[model samples]
Target: CTIGFGSKAKNIVNEDMVLAKVLRSQGAIPLVKGNLSLGCLSYHSSNIIWGEAKNPWNHDRSCGGSSGGDAGILAAGLAPFSIGGDLVGSLRVPGAFCGVIGYLPTPARNSVIGCLFPTETDTLNSE
Candidate 1:
């Protein structure tokens, strides 16, 4: 399988990301990785840093964001599963656009330690 992260936070995979560690422990192998916008704000993945991640269905269509790359990879059959974050439909929106399944856990259900960006602060609602 493959894994993708929101560009707003940790763009690269590291040991600090708990979900990556958990998935590795479960025997998942990292295959392909995709690109996203700089700060997870853009709908397209045409960032200068990593380039664009296009929709598998149609090159002209958007894959969605900030988890757009993740959904795109899954839709293209590059991976069976992917890990991504959401703070206002970041995960769900991409999944819908790509015609794949997406899931977001409740804030209390999972830990968000390493996934948080440096500028992030505790809020009344969790992203």
Candidate 2:
């Protein structure tokens, strides 16, 4: 049961991303460019990069931003596994709130992998 959320939610970032590779291999879909997403145009948010992500655990609490939609789906149990990018705490923040794994794969050192199998270890490892 996959679900998505946001005000101006675009499928490219969330829903489509989940199936992009498979769809591409099948030639059933076209490649779409990801948004630079320089910033959010929301006036209601003080953060200014789109409003804060709504915490399903407690709607008044923040989920995370930039990748809020991804977090929301995860928090709500919309999907078993999901993908989200991290320029900041976008991934970690939601994972903490939703009780799931969040990864930050680094491209250095011949591809740095992280959070793929997040454990209490991640919390202890962070410095």
Candidate 2 residue-wise lDDT, 1-127, digit = tens: 1122243344333234323455457865442211112242221112323434566787786555444555566667765555544545656655665566667654231211332223332221222
TM-score for each prediction? 0.76, 0.45
Where does candidate 1 stray beyond 4 Å?
Answer: 1-14, 118-127
For residue 21, what is the lDDT in candidate 1? 70
Q: Mind sharing the TM-score for model 1?
A: 0.76
Flag clash pairs in model 1. none
The 0-to-1 C-alpha lDDT of every candidate, in the order given, reads 0.68, 0.44
Cα deviation at 6, candidate 1, in Å, is: 15
RMSD of 1: 5.4
